[model samples]
Target: MSFFSRRKLSEQELNNYQQQLNEFKYKITKFEDRLDKLQNDLECKSQGEPLQGVNVINAEEAANRVEKAAQKALPHELKEAFDEINSAVENEQQSVRLFQYELGAYVCANGKPQRKRIYHIDALSKKLKKYGYETKLDSNGPNSFLEVSWKGKETSDISKIDPAKKYVLPLEDTECEITDSATGKAISYEVAYACPRDDKWRIIYDRKICSDAVIVPGKEIIDVPKWVRSIEPIEVDY
Candidate 1:
């Protein structure tokens, strides 16, 4: 190539490098501004010194918000059942025993009928309350159940809201498109649906477990591939 051509190319390259450098500097300034805003918000959230009940944050409220958001995003019947379970919880009592297994027999006298205990429902509210919890909401908003972990000191997954796999085709449909009617958080599914209906389709708008629902992950369960919708997990692996 000619000397002038090479010189012109070098100048263009230099300009491109300077433009990239300016973009990086601009991004750094924007990020620093965001960090400062977040820091100020944190300061506002943790504004008080330690105090008893008077200045305490209610964990129930936080959990309820999470549940409510899920519920409101679900259908009416589902939210109703959810409310029923939440109502059954004894105040300040975290764990609840709802049903007992048939003591799942071994069909042999050698074993003690394998007394397998099944725990669920209101047992959830209290168990979740025990952890060290904090949410960015007003302290005087709503009440919540808080539980401390029996094993670890950290408060991440204190408890699982064990859903009763009811409506096992004995109910209605499994796969559903639900939303929190109250909050509008949405979920679309292609699983089984199990519920009662008058030949009319009920638009699900909240948290309801459609038992035996088929959820295919990383592949298409329906004709049109739906991504971002994680297959509903029947059980979580710790």
Candidate 2:
């Protein structure tokens, strides 16, 4: 064969190239227009003032908080812990109930990791993802655990938590305290302690990342409850 196969480009191939170039140019133009519009819109919105939902925490209050934290002896540690706890409550609004997860001697079932063969907490990650969560994944067992998150204060059409198949969580080896909010009234309500913490669920992720396998959404969003779920549906028991 000759070094150069002297075949001219076909008309159809030339047309295809021209069409592709034209399409690409059109896309570029569209993108530029979008960019320009976005910049203008942002400028207009900025000038127009805050969005409807945005609550602007005043700079004075924010600065005061920082100053207070600075005066504390263990400012850094206390602030970080406080922030974490506050964040957890905001996401899992089931009234700030705290529980522990056992991480030592844990095992994985099927394709996912779990604390025990039974206390399926892997479901928590899925749920949290649905409710707009990401940032951290506290080790959920032994020396650590997935930190407790918000349980939307509604009865999620979840059935009786299954013992065999539910994703595993660290069993509360000993009794844990769950304090009541209303105590200092005419009728004295005492801080409550509960044991055998099994009837709760949490949604957790591997670690702080934008995307992961565990919290992936389902097709119908309803199928989610079946797969990405919880045992301790509201508060921390595990």
Candidate 3:
């Protein structure tokens, strides 16, 4: 055949094309039948009847059960950890909690940073993800706060924290004699503020970020308390 010239089809070729068409039609029909069966199966399930050998369940109910199972499967010491955090958040009307394993350590949401050795991080990741929150696990464990993507926005360098506001813990009746790790000085300091916008906690020495001030862990802490020591939420009144 000349370049760009259409060649007449041979009788055998026409027959072959027809056969291929028939095969495609048969496949399309088979696919449609399967799709219809699936639709009917779903409809029946929606009507409170499951297909043979399949138990129908409400999606939400199923999810609840799965969540329950996940909660139950947590190590005994770690069990109810998430629930405890949630309860505290609910009680305080806050969206996040910051827990430090040690007095001065990487803050984490689910568990203490040092406890990463005992707790299964993958399991924690699963539970957090299932709860519709985004998380990042460092070598130590989960981050200090649970990240939530809003408006279908991709996770980027753009901060979710408010720059104007500071995540300071209640100064009322919160005082500690803990030594400043950054400086080898024994000093008495009250609980300081966390700047989630900057992803750091500033140790306030007489209301100033002194040489001994240290940064706290977390991506954002909009309205969360300045800091918490346990995954169990402590209700801080503002």
The weakest ten consecutive residues by lDDT in model 2 span 188-197
lDDT by residue for model 3 (1-238), tens: 1112234658875675455545533543344344334455567888877489655556575556545433433432132234444455445433433331222443232222322112334455555444334555445333443332211113322253344432233222223333433463544443333222333222232232222122322333333432322112112212
For model 3, the stretches where C-alpha displacement exceeds 4 angstroms are 53-238
lDDT of 2 by residue, 76-173 (tens): 22223334544554464533222223334444433334333211223433333443333234553443334443333343343533332312221111
lDDT of 2 at 44: 52
Q: List the residue pairs that clash in candidate 3.
A: 169-226, 201-216
Which 10 consecutive positions of candidate 3 have the poorest summed lDDT? Answer: 229-238
* Residue 105 accuracy (lDDT) in model 1: 30
| lDDT, model 1, position 36 | 36
Candidate 1: tens digits of C-alpha lDDT, residues 85-183: 334432333332233222333222222223221222233333223212111211221122222211212221213223332112111222244333345
Residue 58 error, candidate 1, Å: 16
Each model's lDDT = 0.30, 0.32, 0.36
Candidate 3 TM-score to native: 0.23
lDDT of the structure predicted as candidate 3:
0.36
How good is model 1 by TM-score?
0.18
